[model samples]
Target: MTATLDQPTAVATGVVVRPWRAVLLRVEGQWTWYRRHWTASLLSSGLQPVLFLAAMGIGFGSQVRPGPLTGGMPYLAYVAPTILVSGLITIAVAEAGLPVLSGFKWKQDYWAVASSPVTPGQLFTAELVWITLRLVLGSVLYLVVTTLVGGWTSAGALLVAPIAILTGAACATPVMAFAATTKGDGHAFAAVNRFVVMPMTLFAGTFFPVDRLPVVVRPLAWISPLWHGNELARGVALGGLRLWPAVGHLAVLVGLLVFGLVLGRRCFRRRLVV
Candidate 1:
């Protein structure tokens, strides 16, 4: 290889050197924060999806066997992406919960960090970035678990790992935005999860196709960030991604992310100052 470099190589003192120190520092900080509360993290992300995967896919799979969802596929393969998306949503929900509450109430660490070198917007951005990082980790772990439990297919499902991260980030934008608006715990998160997150998770076609549900219920899936992410994940995992549909998934995801970020920044300013 003629000088392999994953990042920028600069000429320093007449020598070509890659400065990874900054990247390494950020990685260390992320890891430091992650390790402190990884157990609760795993409960929401990895285990939650795994449980659903088995309960519906294997347990109830016999009841729905040989259907379109099977798609001439094993029930496990067909359901894998949905599980991955649910895992992403679970991660998103976790991101929306305690961390937001802690930042506003228990810890107040975010305010302190914002007061220093970091601005409120930067603090929000950093936390969002951290959520994405967590999403990536949880997705990878879930994929591995699924694989070992016999969910891997075509080696393409391996690609679903990082896609889960993007899927997670897509929803995380909204989660963080929602978090940024809060003045107190005050059961705000409880309401968001009960009303918003729960409905999305249940009706969002994660376990089965939206068409299977009544027409009245299917529309909710269209509005859900997780549903779009699930569609994208299923397409990628099953190799069913067509141009228009793929573009549709991407468009919806990006739109949600943009909306979340823009609204979230405003919320950050409002909550942090006046």
Candidate 2:
């Protein structure tokens, strides 16, 4: 009897497949779910930011005259980019935090997904991609509204979307990692929102220059990813950021995002694979 050994079909055919294809399939599944509820998502991600701009940037800003802090521009112009970053961060935190916990605990969806060919790292990447899709959609809407409200000053303002997404990733990845490790219902997420996110939004130069803050507390804003985002967004929108400073801000955001991704991947593997 002559037994023939089977050849590796993929190598023989010269067809190499990427591992990230599985991650994209998972992202497609998330897109399907998002499509069904896109209206509600739009309300939260799109309309909410517009309302905030209307109320704070326009209505409240009307009373504040141009000043040194505002660089002789309307307060609306000064605060618009900051608000955009704020909205991105809020949405990012929500998408990454509780839903992540639900995936592991309430719904056990992570377990279900892991049972397939998809690895834990791919699942984490898919989650980040889903969150990024939401941020991009929301940010586009915000930019349209900001333009209508006279918030776009420089053409460079267009860079806000990608910068905001980067900022969101900086915040979301670490939060997702924490959520992956949670063993209970997501009570801790609420605390994080109330304590950490709230303070960051208030103090991260969203409403004013961080330098204007007390010297003792200025370091707090210095360490906030939101502050870095706000600085870049406002600088680009106002046509003031130098090339080297812009590169530095981008590097900081990228660094945080990378660190968080590493931590999130490890946590996801620990929670799902073991």
Q: What is the lDDT of residue 259 in candidate 2?
A: 91
Which candidate comes out best when scored by lDDT?
2
Per-residue lDDT tens digits for candidate 1, residues 197-271, read: 777777787777888888887787888877877787787788878889878878887887778777776777777
Over 4 Å off in model 2, which ranges?
1-17
TM per candidate: 0.83, 0.91
Clash pairs, model 1 backbone: none
The RMSD of every model to the true structure, in order and in angstroms, is 9.7, 5.0
What would the C-alpha RMSD of candidate 2 be, to one decimal place?
5.0
lDDT of 2 by residue, 87-162 (tens): 8898899989989998998878889988777788889988998888888888998999899878887898898888
Task: Name the regions of candidate 1 deviating beyond 4 angstroms.
Answer: 1-30
